[model samples]
Target: MSKKCSFLYGTLAVVLGIATSGSMVGSVYATDYSGSETIDLSADITDGIIIKSGANITLNLNGHTISTTESEDTIYVENGATLTISGDGEITNIAGKANIFNNGTVTINGGKITHAGSYYAILNHGEMIIEDATVTSTSEGNSMVVNGYYNYTSTDERIGYVEGKGIANPTMTINGGTFTGDIKNCIYKGDDGSINNISGGTFSGAAACVLQNVNEMTISGGDFTNNNSGYPVINNQYYDDEIDKGVVTIEGGNFTSADENSPLFENGDNSTIEISGGSYSLEPDEEFIVDGIGFNQQDNNRWEIDAPEEPETLPTVTEEQNPATADDILTTAGILATLMLGLLAIIGALGFNKRRA
Candidate 1:
């Protein structure tokens, strides 16, 4: 062959080899899970994972990482499907819509999810259970949003209410994890019929640590802190309508506010908050008072109210009113000490009498 032809042929051969290798690498990294199956990540993936099948799917991270810059979600769970994450791994969304956009059930046992830009770390329109995980959002938006959809239409006669038309109401349960969203709410529930339960976690935010418009939330244990001045650590947006009422029960948690004047909780018009136990602290200010729409201190560690100025028909049960007397405790301790000393004296006398005999 001529010199020029030989050079062209060599270049073509090299191009073909590169193309073949690229295809092989793509095939090795790409993963599309469907049906009821479990997949373990063997290597770091660039392309996002999509779940189209309406079946239960399990993705084991296996200490790998999935990083993507695509506009789509890093992990998308379609409606009528379920996705469970197991093992330790990290999901990095550079500019995606969401790190995990769950329209179905998504359970995270162990993982690290980080999202940047305007999207949420987890936009849940279905059910989400974070047993153990770390979720962080650098965006100004919320870190986790449990949303419900409703449409209202007015007719000549009356207004019609349609439920479950757009996005289904979500139910989120956080047993143990760490959620950090410094700009907006760490967790937000937008509509009614949604349930949020946080048994254990650390939720920090610049605004409200948790905001619920019209929903029910039960917080047993967690550290909720609001770093900026906007709403309280837990805010229930006020609504005068009876149907738009929200309910919150703080069984146990540490709630703090950066601003001294800010209330640890802001109960809405018809909303109610029942605080059983939690450590709460605010900046020392004698003028500052704990006030809300319906605020009542039922006990030293409990507060309950339905709305402002509502009559307290129920009996007031306060720790101070019916407390254990210090004298009672001291008397019991003294009795126990006297019984022990009497026994010791009897034993000494028996030994002395036996030696003399």
Candidate 2:
């Protein structure tokens, strides 16, 4: 079916599904679109959309909202599926689970995933690339919960989740986004992968970023503000095993905390956190500081790079005050010439007197 017909049917389904209030009754539309498909929502949708199989779906909000009042995800992508969300629209879940639940590849280019059920705004189990988006929750929950893999061998298996364990990591590259929530950790990175790069984003929460069983992570740029007074800006939890230990490289960013004396970073045991760059409101752990980089306090509770010292200058000397000046040499030469001429005239006068005698 065409996109125009899909929108008409979607809106009609929502309208006809309920008689009293505008709500969806039973199971919403589940899309198993093969190959590639783009669905543009002309009106707001009060249902959930699931991308099944190996299909690739691009759902454009088109300046509209796709939300559901039921306890379900606004958009769900099954394993092996690919979903690319675009437009300046909103994907919200009211009194429900995460706004966008992904078990496959999901790339959010531009949009907002806001949920209210104190759950993750975006629960990512597979590869996720958030270039630009606003993933936030009003209640107390992590904004973006990234999972890798863990042992969930049970009837209710929650993949990529195991209390405080994450082994096989997921691949997530967050180039740009606006992630905020009133939770302990804004971005819960339980998936410890070797290639997780968070280049740019705006994060604000109790602890702006958290890392557990991290293999390797490089955060080159971002704006992180920790609102909670007790927590640090970046908290890397400890893992006991030697093989599971990993490194965290912080190249550049703006890290600050609301509390003046609170530490900006907490490097738990067994993790090597090398902070070579960034601006902080409080001091970081001395162990994480890299060599050659000066850490100076710019202002109250502000620490950044320290500038080098200036060179010293000497006083200027005048020619008149100097002993070996050109004027003194000329005066001595004139005196010597006058004295020599007088001596020659005296010798000539004596010789003339002797000749007369």
Candidate 3:
């Protein structure tokens, strides 16, 4: 073929490729990964992502932003979808809608979620795990992570902060993250039958690091601080419930409050606070402390679980109950037998000497 014909053929192929590119725009558009593909955001998105069902997508922000000016979720996750957000990027919402409204499962492995809105940075009505991320709520009433409503009678009533939208099970696990907010909670759960697990995080709220209301919360580990003068680091409020089964079990954490008058933990209203383990800048109130558990207050004014004392044990001597073993008994018998034989020989020799004389 001639050079001109070859160039014309190449241009045709490029045009055909653009015409056949369905939803996979690669970088220009925020689309699905029907083949479980990773989409790197080459530019900031004004219109947010509404993930389709059964689509598992990994969106790498790549130091870009996924911001929306409209009053809609920045990332609307539908049911049966799994969205893994990674890279050092930003997800912000200028409107009143949530930055991330999850109805399926959303795992934030890394990113920054900041919002200047009336809603939460994350409004979850499904399973959400924040492994390592930063979520900041600047407004006084805005929160970092809030869960939608859940059906208490249904078995789907699981972990999350409830009070928004849903027919889905709300479960939020904060494994590792940096959450900060103003008057509202950095993390909160108020829904009936709500259960939240915060194993690791750095949470700081002007009001409370964790504002738990009438439910279960297992804070295995974290660093919590509250700047509010009236509220504690963990403010738990339990109103009257028919089941009477809501409990806040704080297994471990580092609690601190800038307000010296405020306690690290506050058993507000009718809440039951079971603190088996934690390190508090100040002492925990007697009502909140677990029974039979001791806290060691260090010189630095921090209080933690007292070191477990080792039980005094006697030294073991034999396989069974004995000071003298079988070997000791046998040796004693042999020595006695030898002495008797020697005595008998001496008597025999004396008798022989007398007879000889």
Best by TM-score: 3
Candidate 1 lDDT (Cα, whole model)? 0.63
lDDT digits (tens) for residues 218-333 of candidate 3: 88998987777766677566644632235778899888877678767666666788888989988777777779987878877788876778999989777666778779999999
Candidate 3 Cα errors over 4 Å, as ranges: 1-35, 148-168, 183-187, 208-210, 239-245, 309-357
| Model 2 lDDT per residue over 76-194, tens place | 76767888999999988875577877677889999887767776666666678989998776656443555553333322324533332222345678889887765555555644332
Quantify all predictions' global Cα lDDT against the true fold: 0.63, 0.67, 0.70
Error of 2 at 61 (Å): 0.7
The clash count for each model shown is: 0, 0, 3
Q: Alpha carbon lDDT of residue 128, candidate 3?
A: 86
Higher-ranked by TM-score: 2 or 3:
3
Alpha-carbon RMSD to native, per candidate: 16.2, 10.7, 9.5
- Residue 53, model 2, lDDT: 53
Per-model TM-score, in order, reads 0.63, 0.70, 0.74
Q: Which candidate comes out best when scored by lDDT?
A: 3
Better of 1 and 3 by lDDT: 3
How far in Å is the alpha carbon of 233 misplaced in model 3?
1.5
TM-score between model 1 and native: 0.63
